[model samples]
Target: MVKLRLKRYGRKKLPSYRIIVIDSRNKRDGKAIEELGFYNPITNETRIDIPRVLQRLTEGAQATRTVQNILDRAQLIAKEEN
Candidate 1:
C-alpha cells in the first residue's frame, strides 16, 4: 500500500517535513515515490502540488491524519455531491 506521509528533515529543534508518497512497508525516510510538498513548522510555511496530490489520491493513496488536515486547510479536495 502507498501512503502519503511526512518525512522529517532539517536540523535538530528546527524540523521541517516533506510530504511524500511511499510504500507502507519501507523504512521512514528511506525513499519516496514522489515528493508532493513541503512544510516548515518553525516558519509556518507550506507548499503543495495540488494536481499531483489529486492524481495520487485518485490512485488510492491514503494521507496521514496531519496531511489530511493540511489538505483540508488548503481546500484541495472537492466537495462530495449530495
Candidate 2:
C-alpha cells in the first residue's frame, strides 16, 4: 500500500514537512517515493504540485487528514475536472 504522508524535517522548534508518497510500511521521515509538496506551519505556507498530486491520488494514494485539508484549501482538484 502507498500513502501520501508528511515527512518531518528542519531545525528543532521550527519544523517543516514535505507531503510525500511512499510505502505505507516505511518509517516516517525515511525514504520518500515522491515529494508532492511542502508545508511550513510556522509560516502558514504550503506548495504542492497539483498535477502530480492528482496523478498520485488516482493511482490510489491516500492522504493524511492534514494533507487532505491542505489540498482542499488549495483546490488541488478543481470540481470541473472531477
Candidate 3:
C-alpha cells in the first residue's frame, strides 16, 4: 500500500521533514514515490502542494495521523483563501 508520511531531515534537534508518498513496506527514510510538501515543526511552518495532495488522496494514498492533521489545517486554510 502507498502511504503519505513524514521523512526526517536536517540537523539534530532542529529537524525538518518532507511529506512523502512511499510504499508501506519501506523504511521511515526510504526513497519516496513523490514529495508533496514540507514541514518544519520547530517553526510550525508548512509548505504543501495542495493540489497534488488531493490528487494522491483521491488515488488511495493513506496518510499518517500527523500528516492527516497537517492536511486538515492546510485544507481549511486553502478553503478560507478561495
Q: Which pairs clash in the backbone of model 2?
A: none
> In candidate 1, what are the lDDT values of residues 1-82, reduced to their tens digit?
9999999999999999999999989887979999999989888788989899999999999998999998886674345532
Per-model C-alpha lDDT, please? 0.90, 0.91, 0.96
Q: Rank the candidates by TM-score, best first.
A: 3, 2, 1
Native-structure RMSD, model 3: 0.9
Error of 2 at 50 (Å): 0.4
Tens-place lDDT per residue, model 3, 1-82, is: 9999999999989999999999999999999999999999999999999899989999999999999999999889889999
Each candidate structure's TM-score, on Cα atoms with residue i matched to residue i, is 0.88, 0.89, 0.94
Give the winner by TM-score: 1 or 3: 3
lDDT of 2 by residue, 1-82 (tens): 9999999999999999999999999999889999989999999888899999999999999988988998897785456577
The true-versus-predicted C-alpha distance at residue 55 of model 1, in Å, is 0.4
Backbone clashes (count) for model 3: 0
Best model number under TM-score:
3
RMSD of 1: 4.2
The candidate that achieves the highest lDDT relative to the unseen native structure = 3
Task: Name the regions of candidate 2 deviating beyond 4 angstroms.
Answer: 76-82
